[model samples]
Target: MTWPLQRLTAPDPATYSPRQQAIHDQIASGPRGGVRGPLAVWLHRPELAARAQDLGRYCRYDSSLDQRLSELAILVTGRVFGSEYEWQIHKGHALKAGLEPAIIEAIRCNRRPDFADVETEVVHDVAFAAHRTRDLDDALYARAREVLGEQRLVDLVGLLGYYTLISLTINIFRVPPLDGGAAELSDV
Candidate 1:
């Protein structure tokens, strides 16, 4: 299937306004190593880019949930939104963080993944439910709270919320995956 032309490409760095240059440099210097994808698209609004990237840094790096759990939540968010760029970007991170490959595939195909522990399962459940329903019902919320504890649960929700914004940006702008390959999310 063909994708629509990307609505916004990164502005030429040499032509960047001072504000853009500053934000671009900051983003490039951070853990992301470089700016591309949704972050790049956001560079058009330097203030938005700067603020969002700061939140993104916290969500991606310093959240209370460990890398494995964070990546799991990110994958679920990407899949639920059918954000191809988001999915392809984080699939590698999820694997490197030690989430099972089968679980990743299951999420891509919209199937129930068999998680090995209650923590993983609870994180998945919270992400899936929150995305599908737009709000958590009482029991699942209680379960997630109980399983993830207060701080982790809060961070999990914040992480999910952050990725949701990322997904929206990717989808709205028709952002293609960075790999520039055929789309990987079939059932999404």
Candidate 2:
């Protein structure tokens, strides 16, 4: 796949610096079990890659939020950023995690998804508000806290911040989809 920018190169395991090599091994052995996407881009600076991989592991695998809510925040972040690579990476995971096709499609199209319950809608609202306005409004804050509880609310913020970082790396590096897929989103 052709990337928007040609300045960066993907990291090769064979050619990695010692620091990169160790980081690569850690990630390859962890839940992700392979290094790619933003991880590859960040490998240019092995230190950055190591720290990012640590945080990424926690956010993606060990978060307080369940898989469904985690995937929702990820997909919403992808949509908000138009991060095709991000969307392509998580859409299937979201579906497998039991996010409805209709809700996923709505988010893919940048519309409000018809959530099956208030909790899912609250997750969406919190994610969307964070991306769209830089902060959540008071009512939604109360709703998210009321529905998700304090721990989940904190995890939601962490998820949002992590995905924002993911989107930024994907967009700035012009990371291609894992499948080398073509563009899947455009300005509406």
Candidate 3:
């Protein structure tokens, strides 16, 4: 499939403003190791980059949800937005976080994955519902709260919100996957 050329370019490090350089340095030194994709695009506004990256670091690294479950929610957000960059980047993360490959494939293909546990199922359902409806029904809310607990439930929502911001940035900026890979998601 034909992909649009990226609409924005990250500033060269040599050209970065003092603030930009600081944020870039901080991001590169952290678990993310570098600024790329949407984060790179955000460098155009260093304040946004700094603030968003801080929140992103929390969502990705310090969230109360387990990594596997967090990845599940991120994948759901990526799929919902048809953000190939987001999907391609997080697919590896999902796998590394021990999310089942079959479930990842199912999400990629827009199929319902047969989750092996209730918590996984609840995470998937909450992610799906959060994107599709933007609000949870009473039953799902109660189930999520019960299974995920209050802190995790809140963190899960924050993770979903952060990834949604990511997806929008990637899509709006026409960010390409690493190495200009083929699209991982097609209309389903």
C-alpha TM-scores of all predictions:
0.96, 0.94, 0.97
Q: Give per-residue lDDT, candidate 2, residue 87.
A: 93
Local distance difference test values of all predictions, in order: 0.92, 0.87, 0.93
Better of 1 and 2 by lDDT: 1
- Which candidate gets the maximum lDDT versus the true structure? 3
TM-score, cand. 2 vs. native: 0.94
For candidate 3, what is the lDDT?
Answer: 0.93
- lDDT by residue (tens digit), candidate 1, 1-188: 67789998878888899999999999999999999999999998899999999999999999899999999999999998999888888999999999999999999989999988999999999999999998899999999989999999999999999999999999888898866757888545
- Which digits, one per residue and each the tens of the lDDT, describe model 2 over residues 1-188? 46566356667767888888888888788888688888888888888888888888888899899999999999999999999989998999999999999999899888898877988999999999999999988998999999999999998898889889989998887888876786667644
- Candidate 2 — which residues are off by over 4 angstroms? 1-6
Q: Ranking under TM-score, best-scoring first?
A: 3, 1, 2
Residue-pair clashes per candidate: 0, 0, 0
lDDT of 1 at 107: 91
Q: Candidate 3: how many backbone clashes? A: 0
